[model samples]
Target chain A: MTDSFSGQEKSNAWSIKRRLTILYVVSAFGILLISTVFLYWVLTTRLAKEDGQFLAAKINLLREILAEAPNNKEVLQEEVEWETAPFRLAKYYARILDSRGRVLIETGKMDTVAPSYIFPRPARLGQTPSHAAMRKSTNGHSLLVMTALARVGDSRGQTRILQLALDISHEDELISDYRSRLLLVLLAGILLSAGVGVFVAGRGLKPIEKITRTVQHISAHQLHRRLGQSDWPLELNELAGAFDGMLDRLEDSFNRLTQFSADLAHELRTPINNLIGETEVALSRERVVEDYREVLESSLEEYSRLSHVIESLLFLARAESSEARIEKKLFDPRKEIEDVIEFYEAMAEERGVTVTYRKASAAAGSGFVNADPTFFRQALSNLISNALRYTRQGGKIEIGVEWGTDGGLNISVADNGMGIEPEHLGRIFDRFYRADSSRSENKPGSGLGLAIVKSIMQLHHGSASVKSEPGKGTKVTLSFPD
Target chain B: MRILIVEDESKAAAYLKKGLSENGFVVDTSSEGDGGLALMEKNEYALVILDVMLPGRDGWDILSEIRRRGIATPVLFLTAKDSVQDRVKGLDLGADDYLVKPFAFSELLARVRTVLRRGPVRQPDILNIADLEIDLLRHRAARQGTKLDLTPKEFSLLALLARRCGEVVSRALIADQVWGMNFDSDTNVVDVAVRRLRRKVDDPFEKKLIQTVRGVGYMIEND
Candidate 1:
């Protein structure tokens, strides 16, 4: 358990559960300690006051009895009888002295063990009663002593010093017992709070544990599974949402990768099958010299097809992986577009399609852009070729260059021919996606034209977009950053 | 037999023309889909060999267009796309057969024969005239009950002429059917092959069954 706890600490210094439990226990302990101390103090002060009151009350009763006496002798007799009374079960001692320090009256209880030093000496008249020091009697009983000045006889000018002592051993025992019991209750309360802290902390962190379990069950193949966000706490809900968002992106990329492989397999299979079928059939029969020559020529065609596919695939791979380098240079956009148009003019004329170039009036002034001329021209060439392929005889294809509203360059190719449907426009830039498979079947295209164009724009930190209406026309735009 | 080849690739089209011509069929070639479609609409053909990828129009569109016009011409799809879906689509679009590109001349010729044999204008099982008998199914040719040892091309050449015994088949037609060549190459390949074929089929027999109409073509006739 220690090993596991240390490992967990390495990951997160203290887990939430442990931290919460510690916080709860520490706070509870602090509050419990303060209250226990307060209660103990109140109890001790009240007990001490009660003990002092009891001693004072006893002294007042003795003074009253002395005042009612007719003479000093009777007072002495009364004091002696009071000390020996059956109601006075507690240990007690008392004495009365005249102004000259001569003992006037004394309790018989003091004859065996009297604490003379505990009585105040030379007490001032009319002084408030004061507690004297504690003393032990001969029987080893602890006592509290008090002293006061009083008038014991009927004479107004006469004063006496009164000293009293009471046994307090039993009260001390009760207070000690209460103190020990209070301390035990305080300790038990702290321990119970710690136990409660752990339980509350565990309940509070249950959502995190649930999230961890759900996350643990997710693997690459099960990326589609999402963490439950509904029943979680607010903070944990946000975490689950973020995690689910990440999975969404992961699953999207995974699906794209799978689709790419399937498309690649299909694209590669055609040429391979052609090569196999052709060679197998050729070798099946013994043919004349001219027939053998024809077979080799056909085989070379299939080989070229294979090489073309590989080259295109390699270029795509490099571009997608960011391994393809772009050498940007300041050049005239108009000249580049014209050069591309010139290159495709022959093929366009062969198809009886007219190609034209247009420039916005503002673009003619400063139409230069910093870009890789070769790749830029290639991107334009792909668009032009696509337009030419879709355009019909006598159809007009226009290439236009202009300054975009965002201070960038926008080069567009528009053709008045068969336009793409809106549904296909979104995926037109995806690799191996063709707008119309039936129409593209006859065209000599690898179906990577738009994808390559998109990649080129990406390498140049630009974007490509298309707008078209079926049977009307199609326009493709390439935007470059300023 | 007269066949139409609609292929966008010039070289492949030339090869197909040569191979079909040398096999004793008259072959017409078009490098674009629209041109092939126009040609097919103007004339009747025994078979139409179409490349799926074309410039102006595609093979599927052309096939559908012809089929829509109630033209029951058998179409054979010749393409570089050999995917099962592509093949299935071609067949679904009323194509009689499908052959991928970079194909052997012999295989194309055989498929062309198979298509032609199944055509509406069927030929007899055995073409017989002037004691010369050609077995179309067995690919065998014999004169007067004596078996003839002939190469495949030679036998095809004999069978072609014997089928049209009294008609003049042009050199262009023979070249297109036998060698699958679209344009005449400046060589005596066809003449040389024919001379060798005549040596085995005619030179061995008393009466000559092969004769050349000067500047026109060759024919087998009982004179």
Candidate 2:
């Protein structure tokens, strides 16, 4: 993977950004080296030209001086001899040669320097005291020889020329040393930039590595673990906040699911215990026909209770899964409630609890509503049963159904019993939540009744609410949308 | 009255023995089908309570073997596998009664009395235990020519115990037998009724017939 990422052919071995930066510095140093070499070439060439010019002028003066003498050749030779003396000038080396390109003046020093030299040829040389630079070789010594032709004593006599040469080996050595130092500086700069690039890349990617490790250690059960958003860099802080928020939601849902399952098991235990107890009792004894019949009856009752609890649990589960299909049909809510209340009338009468119903005058004609009759009846029955259980023997219980303002339906059950306290009123619909006395002492019921009612109401696209005072009474209202 | 217990578990069988012997019934036990059948073939028992899930030979097999051999001892099947089909099947297999497991001892005693009684038409109208005699058909109780006016609950409670005179009966069994399914465990119905019955049946007498076993149950024993 690293090879693939780094192997873009067009990219320089160094990154484009780094190459550009280094290139700027290295190219400037290269230009500086080239300029220094050019400056040295120009300066040395000009100095050599000036030295040749000065020697030519000196040769003209000597020619005039020697021509004025009584013996020209001997005088010229004597003058050259004096000028070429070793103590004359250390930087200058001069020689005089005849038109035949031979040594004309016998300067003892010049004799060794230019025993055989290529003075400018007579015809090829310029006419009016011209100058030419040439190379000389004598007795295994090499020199940069400059020669100039000139006239003597205002007349062209003997056609003598002046020659000068200088050794430039020391200047060449100094320029070579400077070039080596520049090369070393450029190589060091490249190595240092590569080290800086690596450090910067590692520092920039550190937070990304930290985020990866933190996420890997997190598990569903450990929702309390957080990314500690404050510790994250500004670039990643938003992501950490969102992660913590999602964990909060997940924790809440997990807690609710566990509690719901526990409540379901707790509710089912009552019927299961009863069933096991009664069946065990019946099986452990020998009985005649009459006694067997009584045991069978109790056993059957327990079986029915078990089936009821199981079916409710199944319905609740299906509702949660969104698989509970309501068998929609038109049903008379008022008549249905009335019939249920009438069915339970005998029990209420036996207990001296009065059962009543108050149906709206228009309800008879407008009682039809689309709902699952089975679930509807179950919801209504649970409400009535809860009412009957709570109310004292002489208390009154009433059921009502009417049409609401938005063409919706409303149903309610009111009981003049020991009403629920304010604190418990809101939580009554939560599964397995029961008010203190009615749940613990007076009567026992699977506290899933209200939860089942709420689920059924949800299936019907309705809402359920409760209104009550501690001692006065309680009214449960259910409303369905049209 | 003679009774037979067919159970696989020895501890349960011993407990049954202790209880039935204390209640005054002549109790015989068998841990297997053939042994129970051999006992049944040699003696005529008033009742036989059999357990369904047994090793070697099951309760149904023993019941079938007894019936096939023409021993018409009244049989009750007590089993832990208490499904509806098991109940129907036991009844069809000629079991006189069926009870599930973990039953109260008093219920077992009640059922034993019920099964031990002679056929409906030939049942003895009067049941007697020592000096105490009960006219069950008339619902009357008397001891040594003294008439006892017992309430309905008291009469039924005493009659059930008197019928199984020497057996130890646990309170759970008594509660199940006396109140049946109508009473909840939270109520003191069984103890209250037993107290009332004890007053009428044993309190006034010098020789106490009804004895209480600590942490166990009540028993009708000789002084």
* Among all candidates shown, the one with the greatest TM-score: 1
Candidate 2's clash total is 11
TM-scores of the candidates in the order shown: 0.43, 0.36
Candidate 1 lDDT score at position A305: 56
Q: Which regions in candidate 1 have their CA more than 4 angstroms from the true location? A: A1-201, A218-224, A227-229, A236-239, A328-332, A360-370, A401-408, A439-443, B1-223
Candidate 2 RMSD to the correct structure: 22.5
Top lDDT prediction, candidate number: 1
Q: Over the stretch A1-482, how does candidate 1's per-residue lDDT look in tens digits?
A: 35773444467468777888788878888887888789878886786676567667766766666666636577565665574354344566677776676776677767466656656553465454544456777677777777777776567776766777777677678778977987887788778888988999899888888898898898989998998678889999999999999899899878877877887787778777877888888889998888777766676656655655665666677676645678898788877777566555545766789899987776454777778887887788778878887899999899888777777788899999999999999888877778887754434677777888898899989999999999989999998877
For model 2, the superposed segments whose C-alpha errors exceed 4 Å read A1-220, A223-253, A264-303, A359-368, A402-407, A437-444, B1-223
Q: How many collisions per candidate?
A: 21, 11
Per-residue C-alpha lDDT of model 1 across residues B64-109, encoded as one tens digit per residue: 9989889889999987764556888999999999986645454466
TM-score of chain A of each: 0.58, 0.46
TM-score of chain A of 1: 0.58
lDDT for each candidate structure: 0.75, 0.68
